[model samples]
Target: MQLFPKTTTFTLFCAFLTLIHAYDVVREYSGVSFFDEWDFFGSWDNLTLGDVYWLDKSDAFSQGLAYVNSVGNAIIKVDNMHSVQSPQKRNSVRITTKDSYAVGSLWIFDLVHIPYGCSVWPAVWSLGGSTWPEGGEIDIMEAINLMPSNQMALHTTSGCFHNYTPPNQLGATLVTDCSTAAGCTVGELQPNSYGSGFAAMGGGVFATQFDVAGIFTWFWSRPNIPSSVTQSNSTSGIDISQWGPPSASYLAAGQCNITEFFTPQQLILDITLCGNWAGLPEVYFPSCGNRGPTGICYNDNVVGDGSNYNDAYFEIPYVRAYTTGGVAPTPTATPFEIVSKVDISTYPGYGSVTIPLSAVTATNTKLQPSQMFFPGNGASQRISWLQIGVGWWMTSIGVIILIELL
Candidate 1:
């Protein structure tokens, strides 16, 4: 039975405080990171203990349309022709240091849906909790509107840079031949012929794994295999070790690309309105009155603070942290008092208790989406989660607590 070890009640009951340094509250701060806005204040308000994740979106930009039940595999629908003062202000849910992230941690952001067009910019990036880029920024997903699928990249100083390209620019198309690459326009990367079969199956899955070693690997999956990506890269399949530059599988095999660049980084998620990437010369430039002879995307569909942009949001099923086991290192005592030890003292222990999701709020209001209970020694008796601590949140607590992102 896995009891949190007990000491015989023979000597003095000295009390040591368990380093309860972790506080679970997801919210945005007032400061802005390098590549974006300042007026917007993003946050994770309703958060619970378990895999507490829900979607927060703005219907104003999306025309109030949502992608669910796999219809059209269209999770996002942004208008490239639209222009805005701050791309960062449009539809961005910031995942900041307040969310508990740091070096030696991994963050996995999974997305599946429409990933291209003009002026549409979707990204998963990070900023330093203390400094700006010096704290490090990792961009897991940065797909300029127009490409069929997505692009993986990193942003850091020269001394700390971490970036990767899809095996080929045809990243998502390699899994599904959705790109009409042949009909590609001026700034757009893929042919107009492609939309990746996002409609056929459910949306696809895009994930990033940041390791303690400071390596970041990004990959994607579509409803069907994308021919566009395969045409761009050398390998294609359910297993995409040969796909990204620093493939996680490749690293397992003793090779590296991501680790070579940035060793430690924070993961961020944001959908900007119009900025560097979305406002590229070849991209949303046409709508800005910068047109070529043919005049495609030159109509200027959007003017100021564009309306009716696609509502792109993420439905996170779970976020977990794990470690590949190694030799046992020297054990340090965890300072947690035995308020009431788990009743493992009984072989077939007492039954478990269920905690109300609402009862576990730590100011963020994140409810419990999943449950965790440990039954000891095949014991009949069990215990559900027990509350060890509670309190209002502090700003300093946002740092130091490592968010286990995998």
Candidate 2:
């Protein structure tokens, strides 16, 4: 017969800790649900965009710039009514999430199309405060005019900059100092990475992970998306660890203190016309100069020359946030003691017991998760059983002593 039946039972107990450890989907925004979760910004236009035909905030639905479509997708588009002769302000939409998120979370964006064209500036970025870059801004995706590649940027107060290392998987670093008004940027080199090129390639996925280490962003254009990310639902496991190399990585290990520079930020999606970046005649003409009259493109030409606003929009499939189960803390060090060397030769009878000094010292022990298992259905009951199991082991240790004595 086994000396300790309880000990054997405890050792074989199996625990299914799927819920407590797995990353939970904190929030999901899509279709009509997306409209409900996000708040429409109806205030006067602010980005200093000279060419935009700002729509009335009160008549957003009537203007056809913001609404849920018959297919149940959240539709935010620009008005096609404006033309060069009329030069009427074209209707556009801007919206932000009602909720905010902090560091140590993963954000995923599945887009069907994003804005592109002359004098068109579209962006999906995150911000913390109204006083500009003080609270910091993370420009997840932003571009001006018909740029081929996606641009990712970070804007913050002085002293925050990138600690660049070789082999950046996404794009080349354009600016390292984040405090500049223009912000630090990393530009992607792929032809199909952004704008019309992105649409032609069947859109894609953009994911960002934020933690103590820093922030990392990844892109998977349609067919190339990982199954784990694409197939994940409420119950299915979504392991960020398996997503592979990131396109852009900002490490706070040496230079930036992420927590100090960033704060609880809300997601913003908007498309503006001929604002600060795209307004300059000299800068705007390079990409779209040939298209405009007399080989010239200007801010007013966006509306005056009459470019169709239909293509200047964003079609997002969904946006999701996952609460990361952070790295577990290191276990406490095992108890131990140090003893002075014993002069056994000085002892009379005890001199024969020549035990090595190291042997008597306590062995450092590390308790692995597998060592303790509670075979129960619910968490509360399992916890109760765990306490009982621990008590049983203590009893088993005592019984072992008793057996030795006998």
Off by over 4 Å in 1: 1-92, 102-104, 114-116, 161-201, 212-214, 222-266, 286-308, 311-406
lDDT of 1 by residue, 1-406 (tens): 3122234211111211122221121212211121121112223222211111122444322443223333322232333333545212233343332233323333433344433334444554554333322333344445443434333333333333212222322222111110111111111122221124332344443434444333434343443233433332112112223233322211211222333433333344444433433443444453333422333331332234345344334333222222111111111222223232222212110111111223322333221111111111233113211221111132223221221110
Taking all chains together, the TM-score of candidate 1 against the true structure is 0.41
Candidate 2 weakest lDDT stretch, 10 residues: 364-373
Candidate 2's displacement at residue 114, Å, is 0.8
lDDT of 2: 0.61
RMSD of each: 20.9, 20.7
Per-residue lDDT, model 2, residue 65, is 78
Superposed by TM-score, candidate 2 places the C-alpha of residue 237 at a distance from the truth, in angstroms, of 5.3
Please, what is the whole-model Cα lDDT of each candidate in the order they appear? Answer: 0.30, 0.61
> What's the lDDT for residue 296 in model 2?
41
- Clash pairs, candidate 2, are 49-275, 53-89, 53-90
Cα deviation of 354, candidate 1, in Å: 48
